[model samples]
Target: MSEKNHQGKRTARQRLAVEREKQKASERRRRTLIVAATVVCVLGLAAVIGLLAANSGKSSKSSTGPVVAPSGAQGKDSLAIPVGQDGAKSTLTVWEDFRCPACKAFEAVYRPTLRELTGSGKLRVEYHLVRLIDGNLGGTGSLRAANAAACAQDAGKFPAYHDVLFENQPAETDDAYADNNKLVQLAGKVSGLDTPAFTKCVKDGTHDGWVDKSHQAFQAGGFSGTPTVLLNGKDILKDRTMTPAKLKQMVEAADKG
Candidate 1:
């Protein structure tokens, strides 16, 4: 072969090799994009399913009751399970969701102190119920559990039922409270709570509307997270130095103020 022709053939082979590499890289990028899109689609679908499942507060065969707002309930939209005297020194408004694990922890740690203060007529707590987890993570437990607690309130057993529900709160992802029967079963553990009225209310989802309304209340209050505790309408957890004991002192100061 001529030297010039041989050199030209080698150049052609090098160009072909470079072209092949470019094509392979292009193919790899397309595959990566496709995989990324699929993952995004899957995550979106899961979030939608979660929201729908949480909002699906379908009632089964349970008891019936007047779904009127309980007496002393905060506003027309919220339930008021007040523990202390009406004219107490301080008001502790709690914005909590039933399915929030953090809320369960808050209850476990501060419930006793709360009860003590309220029982002693030094503080009155307004239990502001919200279903943030249901709205965020997607499950009906927050709604169902809140409805059950309202039912307990109807039966004059709010405190007992509320504590019990938190005590046995299932894992955040678990749909334990989705089953109305489970709610009623928990009520059985609370004296004077397992009754025909409570059963009817649970089955009919009588309080579900109020639960929805409470979520609206939480949003209107300019809050974004669960277990949002306000002592006399001031955020306390932001300090990170707040302990149960410190909280008591803070409330005392607020009361004096």
Candidate 2:
């Protein structure tokens, strides 16, 4: 073969080899991208499964039937009394569980706005204590605390005792049984409460039936969670994200209606 032809053939072979190497590099990159995408999808699915599991554990069954207010044997208008009043045309009632962290958070965030509205007569706020966490958080202790607050209400000390309980909620993982002494201490902190009577009521479960009645009322009202607020007998806020700003907007809209 001519030297020129031979040299040209060698060059052609080198060029083909370089092209093959380029093709292999492209294939490797494509495979890497596929694996990366598959891993991301798997991670995303796992995250979704975890979220669903968490929510399922917390979800409660909501009642779809008509709501029945508490019986007159308890008291007339017992379900509708204003725990706090600003004489606003609208009434905002909240159903809460003392052991619920979300209820504590809602109280912390909305107390100021609630005080502003109710104190100024622009709103009337009533709180109904529910016992959702009785089994998990503090069983009897949780129920006892709620019942104690009811006794305070009987003695017209609801607001003070209510504030104290939320302010001093035990650590999240602290069992509800740990709250008994603290609840008694809180009752004592509320001036004007019949301390001895309140103590006896809590210890002897004087208000246990009342607490159960309140929970029944909450279930009747279609609530399945703490911090459920009813604005003027109409269900309004149910989500934990119902912030003060959102509540204020709700009140304003209700006023317009």
Candidate 3:
């Protein structure tokens, strides 16, 4: 081959080699970028899954609940948190849950009237504590708060503690009540409720069984939800004439009849 032609051919081959190397480097970079992006996405997804799993675990851990029976549970009706004379002419059975907002409202408005009637021997009130909110909302607040209320019953401060809890209730979705310490702190607001025995009962969930019994009774009563009130066995919510203002009148009529 001529010297000039040989030189040109060798130069062309070298240029082609350079181009191939460049292409190979480019491909490697592309693959590396794809792998890096995929790794980042996988890590982010794992973090989200871990967070969700941790939240679920917290909820599950709070669900096992306490074991003691309520101190105020009465005969044949083991769920009664009674607030009136033993043989009053009318029995106002109230099914309430601390986590329930409607129950809070009922307590805020009608509780005074009921207490007045109860205090005056005009009516008997059996407050039945229920915990359906925990079953529906996936938290321990309802159960824990109910357990705390039962502890108050043991200290002879149930009604007062009950009012304090509703007054200081967290948001419906919030699990603040799941903390036993907070419950104990709230108990301090009520007279004679924050004793060491009461504190232990609340922390250990002494009346969780009684709370469960109240729930069973609530369900067996054919009621669908909380704040279920009855006057001498008549469903108050289902009655058309039962207004918040007319509660006293209804009690009077029921008592007379």
Candidate 4:
């Protein structure tokens, strides 16, 4: 009888040990699952942060600051056109399309010289905004952007808005039609524009006549491509060869003539 009782106690103890081990195994599995889930969440958060940082960097590099004249002419004249002294003896009228990459490049290179000339009273620069690439690339954003610029000109914010547009113009693709809201946002980036009026003008096509007039003039002038500069309404420069030094020399020669 004593032997039987000993066997029963031993079996009970063995069963309890097995149950304890099972419980331990379950706890370990739970901990492993929790750690894996935590790792996944952390990795996702890191990826999101990295993406945002990259986007922020691109935005900063793309549009740095307000366009300023070159350092040498600091106190002599305001870099902003029309407000500066018209030092130029000859008038330079430029007809450009906002979507034209060549026009943007020209602006990048010649903006400073133009500003300096305008400031020094050596030239009077007039920009006639035209929508040459409206329906072809990105629907009407290109045209809408041009009209917005004219609105800015009316508000005396042409220089600022013009610089901003060239700075922010998208690639030649269908994705460039971002909507009128984007146009308003871009106009707001310019310093002196009246936002409400500018928005209204862009939406209602307030300056369509200006664009039409510019188109007529461009057609009359035989401008097949952009970056066309007319010095006193005569074609003087066409493409990449129109450097600042060359432009200065041309202007000086024209003055002599």
Off by over 4 Å in 4: 1-87, 175-178, 238-241, 252-257
Off by over 4 Å in 2: 1-77, 177-179, 233-235, 238-242, 252-257
Model 4, residue 145: what's the lDDT? 72
- Model 4: per-residue Cα lDDT over 41-151, one tens digit each: 233234334444677645422121232222121221222124344555777877677776667766765788788766666677766655555533425655567667766
lDDT values for all models = 0.72, 0.62, 0.73, 0.60
Flag regions of model 3 displaced more than 4 Å.
1-67, 75-77, 254-257
Worst 10 residues of 4 by lDDT: 71-80
Sorted by lDDT (best first), the order is: 3, 1, 2, 4
By lDDT, is 2 or 4 better?
2
Q: Could you say which candidate leads in lDDT? A: 3
**CA RMSD of all predictions:** 18.8, 19.2, 26.1, 26.0
**Candidate 2 local distance difference test against the native:** 0.62
Tens-place lDDT per residue, model 3, 142-178, is 8789889888888888889888999998877788999
lDDT tens digits, residues 32-119, model 2? 4433433422332333344446777763332222233322212333643355444577787787766666667657656888888777
- TM-score between candidate 2 and the true structure: 0.62
Q: Write one digit per residue (lDDT tens) for candidate 1, span 105-207.
A: 6777678889888887778888877776665556688888888888788788888998898899887778798899999999989888889999998788877
Off by over 4 Å in 1: 1-67, 76-79, 254-257
